[model samples]
Target: MRLLALEASQNSTYYISRYQQVEEFGADLCVLNGEGTEGTWPEDRYRIVGSKHIDDIIAAARAWHAQQPFDGVLTFSEASVTAVAAVAEALGLPTIGFEAARTSRNKLLMRQAHEKGGAAHPDYRFVPELEDALRAGEEWGYPLVLKPTLGAASNFVFRIDSPDEMRERFPQAVDGIKDMAWFTMEADGLDLGPHGLIVESFLDGREFLIEALAWDDEVYLGSIVDRVTVEGDTFDDDVHHAPTSLTPDEVAAVHDVVRTGAWAQGVRRSALHAEVRFHQGRPYLLEIAVRPGGGGLDHMARVSAGYSPIEAVMNVARGVRPEVDHYTPTGVHTAAMCLISRAGRIQEITVPEEVSGSSQLFFFKVTAGPGDVIKRPPHGNNILGFLGATGTSFEDAMSTATELAAQIRVEFTD
Candidate 1:
């Protein structure tokens, strides 16, 4: 089988892992990378920044298919999901449909679709201007969450407690939209139109991520990941631990909510990433993505389970049902932590030998080095590196990972 991957990045360890898994399945991999990412994959390669134009992507795919037909068209990145779905539809291949892909990228559309499908979601309003946002504030009341309709990594996500705070922070939020618009405009079909924001009623609760694969309209529940976020002023992810701390019954309820959200988005065959908030014994859908979760999520899944989500997604792309036994705990716990640093030029980073040599350590990757400038949150790409570990229990795994993460000293220049 020949697989055509859209927008494969060499910088991603996850992408490289998935490529290796595909080859392990005896499938020939052909990558269509973005503008400067040409030499990432040594195999058959094509260059077309898929986000720039769907037609160009389809044209390139068609030309490639003429020589050797591709058995599957897929992508794992959030940026390229819609484009890949468009190409798959053009080729009469399996996909979640362009509408679903569009909805997945836009939070406003996602909330509307979920509500229409009888899936519980927060009350939201599409804010196209400051007036609209103010109106939404009046209707939704205080302590609302304001974010871009299409955004990732919690960039520009603000929690407005009152109209006064909204007035003060509204400009910054609008600026974020402008910054994001620069990229969204270049992406062929993803235009936010003037100004766009989603004001949602804030739900107070614990958050969890649902990782699953859907095939033949049946959702296979994978591990439910417990997400830890930075407290105060930002919603950036701090750590992820799996299998979840949720009880069996709670996990099942989360799974049902995920299934409903996935089906509502018309996701028949794809890797599903759903974020939900549990409040008062009820799970409310936060958002869903038709791509695999990032930050070594697949790695944690492999450590906690016996199978890889990357492999399962590949199987789904090839129209094969993934052999998955959901929520079957492996008697051990796994955790992944992001290496965050203060904003400045990195001078030196030291990882303790003891921590590095530990058997519990799964992998440690550093993306920043000397002279590399580090920015803080709202930039959404502030992570300096990542660390993963496994232990006899969730507490043990989390403690080990947290301690190891603390041992890595990152010195920044004055």
Candidate 2:
């Protein structure tokens, strides 16, 4: 089948990784972006690859449509929601609605919808000014999370437990975000995405995930994945167990929450990666990113759970019924651990031979070699790229990966 994929994250690595996944599954893929092309990506993989501007995606889509009559259109999280919807709408093809995309992209709107639907979420308020957040902080309590309404990889998400902390660090946050509404404003209309920010409680407890596949405005089924993080919050190092570590009851509860969230929002034509934390033994909605999750969440589902998120997403765009992984859970833990660097340029990257040689190590791949600068932002910075094994237990895989990662030395330009 042919898949028209949107790859305009403005982050090269994310697009490349996702593009690779789509191409691997025997689907013909096409690329559209906000900014123009990056390096050279083979046309064999992306048969219709180009740096088409936001307005130009349609023409490109039409050309492809006329030539090939694309079977489907696939896109990630919420960023490409509008473009995909517009493209699908233009083509008289099925797509996630503009309103639903808005609900998913903006955290304030998403949480408010949950509350309206009689679901539980942290107390939150969205305001254009910083002072209002401070006022809300007073009304609520300490230990709050302030973040962009539209973002991924937990970018600029901070947890403040005290007024003193807020006073000490609140002002620096007022820079370089262009949020209005997800669909109404584009870079040309008004920078509509992550410019808007919100503050909510730091919902404390163990975090888990539910991956849902939607068919004809219904979340047909879902899978449970457990989150394992080195740092307490996501901004720090984080990992995932493709299969969760929760009990059956817990998985059921989590999956129910996912269903509830999707049903409540009327999600159609997408994959949902939601974060749920237990509050008083019940699932409290952390945040729902209505797209396939980043950081091998897709791969985990493929390798550990026996499904491809990329292929499933393609099916959604094709208007075909999709299959989602079920609650018949797999391992105690099947981990996808990432080894990160604090900061520095890539002088050299060396993986331990023992770890690389192990049979358990399914895929060990690296991005950087020597003389590449490693930036602070972990999302786009490809210092030491990795794709390694799947172990019997999450803890074992994590510990082994961590131990081996220490030996990988990337000498910075510093």
lDDT of 1 at 219: 78
Each candidate's clash count: 0, 9
For candidate 2, lDDT tens digit of each residue in 1-414?
Answer: 777776443444445767776778677776655554445366543433243344566766776688777777767735666567667777777777767776776777788778887666788888577787788788988778877777655555677777776664455444424321222223233234445668887766778766667665456335667666645323543566657667878776776676677656667557777788887788888766667766666666666666566677777777876766465544534555566676666666666677678666544556555776554432232335654456667668766666666666655667
User: Which 10 residues in a row give candidate 1 its minimum summed lDDT?
Assistant: 185-194
Candidate 2 TM-score to native? 0.86
Worst 10 residues of 2 by lDDT: 178-187
lDDT value for model 1: 0.75
RMSD after CA superposition, every candidate: 2.8, 3.7
Model 2 has an lDDT value of 0.63
User: What tens digits encode model 1's per-residue C-alpha lDDT throughout 1-414?
Assistant: 778888522233336656766778677888875433545667345455544565666777788878888878877777677777788888877777888888777787788789888888888888767777788888868888888776776777888888887786667777766665224532364442324678888888889876788776577767678887656656777788887788879887887888888788777778887899987788899998988877777777777766567777677777877778667766568888888887888899887898778888876767678887776755544668778899888788889998888888888787
C-alpha positional error of residue 105 in candidate 1 after TM-score superposition, expressed in Å? 1.4
lDDT of each: 0.75, 0.63
